[model samples]
Target: MTADHTPGRVTGADGPAPVPAHGPVRAVGVLVPARDERDHVEACLDAALTALARLPPEIVTALCLVVDRSGDGTGAVARRAVAAHGHTRTTVDVIANAAPLRIGEVRNLGARTLLRRLHPVAPERTWLLSTDADSTVGPDWAVRHLHLADAGVDAVAGGIELDGPGRLGADPDPSGCARPPVPDLYAANLGVRAAPFGEVGGFPAVVSGEEHALLDLLRRAGHRLVTGADIVVRTSARTQGRAAGGLADLLRERAAERPVTAVEVPAADGG
Candidate 1:
């Protein structure tokens, strides 16, 4: 929403304000796509900022909140957080998603915009993490990412553990994770290599299947997708409420079609 003019960095003719270029930056850009998410936006930003605090300010250069046009004050909340956080070195960008596109479209738009200003190799050494505005990162989320990167893994598919007593939609399922016909691989906790994410073109503008689609591309390219105890993020069932028809029935409706086109993405190399 603001033009970047931070010292040591050139402001884009039309991009969010740039972070103060105290030194060179590298790492994944956390891209959050939201729509009218004021309900949990503040907590989300706080958690994200907290996670970043674990590392040096120079590493996590920015937080890109892609806010779709909403009558609800989601955008306003994002702006407030940016101001409150003292965006000294951490650049906060508010992108509008007023266009009538689907989930994949939003991520693609954001990833492309952010990638232009980000360090290409950082994602491999860094993570381009994505989460909805209704989600929050774990206490050690960022730290874990750095750890995984140090271990030389390219893609980390971490899952979110819902906050206890989440919205009506997040009831615990005794049925178990495997019982669900279509398991969700949400980007909320997905940490992927930046170069691979870009090489695969990030997310596509589709009604669904964004994460799986991107994963498919990455796997085919022979990147390693590792699961880790680290890199966890807490997500609200409210954002994925559509599956169950309302906030109250979300978890129960886990069985559904894959959001991304499900093709055989070859197994990633363990290397």
Candidate 2:
């Protein structure tokens, strides 16, 4: 079997090269975690692959999907999507986690697997991006993240706009027009350098709020973080999600006011 589909941790000679002190980002590894998300995995992979293609051909880019205890054949569906795209510029791989795991653990697993696959490329110069199976990113998402990294941004927190059909909470205004959402850090839209991510021990193995936890850790460790307002990701509005207290739960918190509409979130101040 190829190393990409191989199980277990990558290390020693088979692992990536030593850390580089400073340089342009030569590689980007994207991680997507799914649990019983057969319906959403295809669109997720499509969006991720398309975004990866937007980057210059010289930059090594890859997408790794971590399917955790999914009985719905999410892994198989993702593989088919990758094959259908047949994208030459980016390598796509899927890992099946038979054991039950939290979203944070799944994300970490996908991150490590992708990072190792990008061997001989120093982790310090690799950008690790995170998204979800129920979300879709625009073609410019990867490019925007790379531009920020190139500008010395160690990590990026992106905004999200609700898509499809569901609303988040009750309209506080009750003026018939929905109030704009207060932007918060979401795993569906996040990016970080592999070095700092590893230094902070990666993401915490929690059910939800892993993204916020990781960013907070990075901040405490003195890393440069910025909000990529242009890197907005469109996430699901199902009102039911993989993790507790996640975006879906937020949306389901209140009864649907009207048909789901795109939520406009205010850009948060940069850290």
Candidate number with greatest TM-score: 2
Instruction: Write model 2 residue lDDT over 1-271, tens digit each, in one string.
Output: 1222222122222233223358879999899998898898899899999999888878898889998888888989999989998887887779889876777888999998988888768877899999999999998888887776665667777777777655543466766786765446789899898988999999998888998889878878877666534568988878767788888777776434455455645354432
On a 0 to 100 scale, what is the lDDT of residue 125 in model 2? 83
CA-lDDT, candidates in order: 0.60, 0.78
Look at candidate 2 and give me any clashing residue pairs: none
TM-score for every candidate vs. truth? Answer: 0.72, 0.83
Estimate, for each residue in 1-271, the C-alpha lDDT of model 1 and write its tens digit: 1111111111112333223232222565678888878888888888887777777655755578888667788899888987787646555678887878777787777776666656444544446777778788876776676555444455666556665433211223566543422233566777666766777777765566677777777767776555423345666643455222322244433323222222121122121
